[model samples]
Target: MSTTEQLELDPAEVQAFAGRAVADAATWMATTMTMFGDRLGLWRALADSRPVTSPELAARTGTDERYLREWLAAMTAHGYLTHDPGAGTYLLPPAHVPVLATESPAHIGGLHQALYGLTGMLDRVLAVFRTGGGVPINAYPRDWFEGLERFSAGWFDHLLPQVWLPTLPELEAALRRGADVADIGCGRGRALIRLAERYPAGRYTGFDVHPESIAAAEAAARAAGVADRVRFECLDVSGGLPGDYDVITTFDVVHDAADPRGILAAIHAALRPDGRYLCLDINSSHRLEDNRGPVAAYFYGVSVLYCMTTSLAHGGAGLGTCGFPEHTARELCTAAGFGTVRRVEMENPFNILYEITH
Candidate 1:
């Protein structure tokens, strides 16, 4: 027998590991319940309201009383809601209001939805693991894309105009002076649409591999009354960018590419001599030893389930989600023929922004 097999199992260690597994499982279930509550408007109905029976909440949200009661019971048991046993009523604490309300900037309910959506692809991910292949981006259900877009909207809405753009005065000046801008891997084009509205003088174009996303982006541009200034196309940017843009932005896209290097090279070639490139990627450490926290764990899980798999599907280098650290980013930019790479001074929990010049 192997040395590991010959070793005796310690009951205490086994119990501790099992206990952690149980806790993790409970957390997963709680997240699913959170998603359900968010999707059904249960949380919103309970927000800023007095403690009341599930029937009252059901009436407020136009849902079935019986179902709502069961859901409320589950939530109460999980400590997501407080139960008044004497009064037979439930309450969503005021402190939890911001985190659950859809319109609130502190809302993290979309993360639960995203986790649920990602778990739905477990079977496909398992098949890929065994067969040395992967599922394509478009193969996943629409909910995954919707959840991602919803989660990203808060950051883009709150940061782009207020914090991100203002940090770079030169880029802002060029943009104001009617520069041509391109957004690569612009899923649904939220950022592009926002930029178009903020800088009407600058012509904006968005490129995405998924036809549905490009179509949706085009529709959004039209709805926002910037269709004439902003356009979207369905194309793989790793092959080549279509225009010599004065500015190019890639938000959380490089590590997920089939050929990140190729995309970088294409961007370098497509940029004007004095143009700038902005890349927002996951904030991570290059070494595994330095990545020992909840955020890192979450990122690794996402990389395995989505980012790495999608890249592998295209026979591309799977950089995983945490593969592009600051050092690695600088190296890649230099190799791609960028003249300068500067890490923008911005504090965000999830991402790091870099400004590149050629």
Candidate 2:
């Protein structure tokens, strides 16, 4: 379909779309700051741990009671905070605090904070599209990188335990049967290090475009004492994957490419005849305007926006305004000469893992 056709709308549909747009904009603005407020302990103070009044919470936190009360009331209206009509007070339930509070490093607070930094890249989106180039990884502020580390650490933790751990035994079995693995666009080499540490018998290599990420991955491999087993190289898989391996993995990297096709084709070329390619990417299926609900829409929108801008700055292909869907990605992989693509649930809700074999 043409872009104009996709955007064409009837009068009522246009009104509904405009209304949704306004609500969406307002929703993102509010939720983007929800984590910051929570990290500052505002949510916990109003939570049901104690039966304190707004003034009491304000005094304890050394904040203004008037503003705090208003914020709490806003949360209550948004269903994040429950309002007790009989008690005539606002409250955050125990269940809500973990997600909101930054104390549980296992919680999503770290990821949310990282996302806040990425959203700052929106200003560069147009420039990137115009130039057909992308910003270097080092171009981001230092705090943004720190925020990314915070997010990546927790993300890796979840992935290893939930997806990789369960699959490791199977992966180990595959390796025991003699599988060589390549991690394409493997930033920081966390996945390669973990695999090499666990399955020393398997040959492993980490490949990425960013020299800094490769350096970091190399250091991590050395620190983990797996440098002999795993190797890191500063190469752009987007150009063409160089070596053939029995098994290949690209985690959370393909979606960031401006030309995902080029990367996928290269991956296809680099796979051994009967080798498997595991791809983990963001879930774009849950992004329908109606089904997405408020908070999810905010996160997904920002994520899509970030992917668009970051792709531009990096001088690769851009995802444009819309993030690619799993089906579209699967089709692209197939077109690149892979067969039998399938999606499996990953440990993280944000990702879907694909098992594609050549």
Candidate 3:
């Protein structure tokens, strides 16, 4: 067979693969449009699932009717909205409200906004890929942090109080009776603030290396009226965390640590003998091939763009996003002198909660 003929086989497969690739590109465009709708409050306008003409939607959202028409047409085509061409009206399906409009667990608005932040770092990440350096946390924009907070809000609001604490009855009792709590690597102090609100008797201190995050946490604490019981400090805990905490918690912090082992050790040291340490890290497989589906894809993508890069920039082990899986976590905890490391049974796709003790 000629070389050209050998290479030119499987035209059907090539076309099919190209179609899938084109669909993937269209998904990105859809995400951008979704972001636009979110920013414009178009989703909120149609949150009641009301069918409205382009002019009516424009009146409600203060958007250009022509742009709204195009967006409505696109979203309708994408099956997120229903169109009544006979009446020249469009409506957001009621079922889509939670996923499209509100700040629920199902909402993707934060994810969309976060893409803005991540895509902004594409050039820097590309350069890092070539130069063998990594992007630092400070290089990321405010939108990144804000979007992350929004994305994680549901967990702090619902899961912590209802599911996580209730499941840990002993810790729940300790918190109720005014336990000394420390949230290391606390971002914007959401978890601690939520804790303070729920358990007013508890004294909470939050520590982070990011000065801006510390400030934001403090401000958030004040706004939540938990400032009296909650305090935030800007500190690097990789060296060691200083405190005799009855309950120490780290939310999605370990995988991105510059010194994961050192931080784990510090956590063990800082906790009182009877103290309990609650760690929430990524829920992933230790093996590369075992990690399948969209969540895993997102983990690897984020690992490259943000988590791993930032850690490496700080001269860390750079375990990447999926670094600390269950086995690795248990090993590290055992190495850190944590006598007991019990994995909390949480029905979550993205996180694993560990209840550790000395």
Report every candidate's CA lDDT: 0.88, 0.69, 0.89
Best-fitting candidate, measured by TM-score?
A: 3
In candidate 2, what are the lDDT values of residues 1-358, reduced to their tens digit? 9887898668898899999999877766667657556556776565455555677778877888888777777666667777666766666677777666534435665566666666666666546656656655656544454455556665565565455546645544676665688998787787777777666888898887767778888888899998877898888777787668888988777767767888889888988887778777766662466336544555455544565556766565766333556767767887998877877645455666777876
Query: How well does model 3 score by local distance difference test?
Result: 0.89
Error of 2 at 158 (Å): 3.3
Error of 1 at 226 (Å): 1.4
Residue-level lDDT tens digits of model 1 in 34-101: 88898888888888757989777888899999888888988888988999989999998888888886
Q: How does model 1 score by TM-score?
A: 0.94
Off by over 4 Å in 1: 1-11
- After superposing all C-alphas onto the true structure, candidate 1 shows an RMSD in angstroms of 1.8
Model 3 lDDT at residue 195: 92
Q: Which residue pairs in candidate 1 have backbone atoms (N, alpha carbon, C) closer than 3 angstroms, thus clashing?
A: none
* C-alpha TM-scores of all predictions: 0.94, 0.68, 0.96
